[model samples]
Target: MAAEAKQTCYEGSSVQSFRFFLEHSGEHQAILQRVHDILPGEFKRIGAGKSSLDFLGVGSGGGELDVQMLTLLQSIFPAVPITADTVEGSSQLTDNFKALVAKTTNLQKIPFCWHIMKCEDYEKQVKAKGDMKKFDFIHMIQMIYYVDNLSTTIKFYHSLLKNNGRLMIINEAANGGWDILWKTYKKELCVDAITEYRSSGEILACLKSQGLKYEEHVIPNTFDITECFNPSSQTGQRLLNFMTATDNFYQSFTPEIRAGILDLLRNKCSTEKDGRVLFNSNLSCILVYA
Candidate 1:
């Protein structure tokens, strides 16, 4: 019944998995800090001349990161009002984001539209409209992996950019802490029909092959998953499941395979320093047409 119920990993508690990621991993801080450091300069170079900015956020999550990025943009162009169009596939996440916006006084001031559909669906809708609207800035943060066709998704989003507009994509770098485990268990764990586990290196290669130009930035970050070493740790088990994009990885794999994966996660993927198990989970950002 468990196996029968498990149709696709993504259809599970994605919001819970995302919450686990933010709570345990340093991704939120690392991403926000990188944007605070790098995005201002990029925005300055663009030099806004209009009174309003058309911004599209693909998979903007629960508006936590969107608010930060929007605030940064406001600081850059203090006079211009931002018209934000957010795209998110998860209904729960979209509702949470809207709720946050409704409760937050500052977020209410910013005009926004929500598209509760997948990127491809949104693309089809826009194309069908006959008068497709272009955006000045489009950002996809750690969301590309959700799409099946990375190349097509990138090109589609790139096509939506106005002249001198910027499209920023953030994803994991190749050979990171989880690379070995991912390579080993991907066939069994990954939902290839919906998700493609491609790192930044692979993405760069794709861009190069397609003759696309972009700037890349590597953000150094780590997360503590020492609990994963303990067989009895439920949090560790969930973390492993989230990392592998599987449902209960500890129970999914055979004893031998599970042991091998745990060993790799402990020794190769992470290191024990000062009594803490730190993982080598860094991220990278690729700025296209910035």
Candidate 2:
């Protein structure tokens, strides 16, 4: 680890918190490109022609993903006006975000235009900007789950775009993560939908309701949740140790429940004998607006 990373470089600095996670994990560039790949080259040509651009992080998290996106924006547009609003209902992650902003060269270049707000408030900002129709791009990543009404949020995002602007949606490899979690756990996510996650069909339905033109693709991809570590092979204990470092699966459960969850997760991960445990993930990307 670098000297700064090893220390509490920005422990109390809320802004840098999100930046640290991305840099520490070395995931910023990779995930940024993954989301970037969803947009065709044509979108850039279209975006380049615009006078100003906006990125509305539906749930603009404070970590790696945010940094990565900002980096790409700098790379592609360099100095075009980018006013990004990362709206979140809760400010628990603000410190992380602050730390990230402090250290990130790209983020520092642009003014930190965090609303510390919610999607509903976006309309006010949109109105103030002239029209809800003037934004270049509006994105909601892993945040639609927190929305009380998916259709309403979708409509809101679409409303923020100029005729040629873009709206992007990204979620985990599986929309079914929510479904699976809900089935197994009684605790509910914030989404008003009884369904845990939105599928491509579900997302498309939202787009159509808003009368927005859009594109969809099954972005085939995978990431080893444990990175190169394998619990069953020579790295087995090391992998377990890495997981142990964090609270991991124990937070949500009683002692017995946690033990059972660990056994299941670990067993599914690998065994004492042969192959390494490899996990697969799917990242879905949806492009809307222009």
Off by over 4 Å in 1: 1-12, 192-195
1-290 per-residue lDDT for model 1 (tens digits):
00111322123475677687788887889889998888998877654576677889998777788888877787789777778899987677778788877887766678888898888888889889867778888998877666767788888899888877899988877888755667666776555333346678878987887888899999888988889888799989888877766667777779988888888888888879988889888888889993
Q: What C-alpha lDDT does candidate 1 achieve relative to the native structure?
A: 0.77
Question: Which candidate's lDDT is highest?
Answer: 1
For candidate 2, what is the TM-score? 0.64
Q: Could you give me the TM-score of model 1 versus the true structure? A: 0.92
Against the true structure, what is each candidate's TM-score?
0.92, 0.64
How well is each residue in 1-290 modelled by candidate 2, as lDDT tens digits? 00111211222332243343344334335446667775546348547677767766666655556667667766787768776666654464555677887888667756565666656666567768774434566667655544557887777667667767777887543433222332343242212222244445567777787777877755543323343243254333332222222212234346775454345443443233234333323346777856
Model 1 superposed RMSD (Cα): 3.2
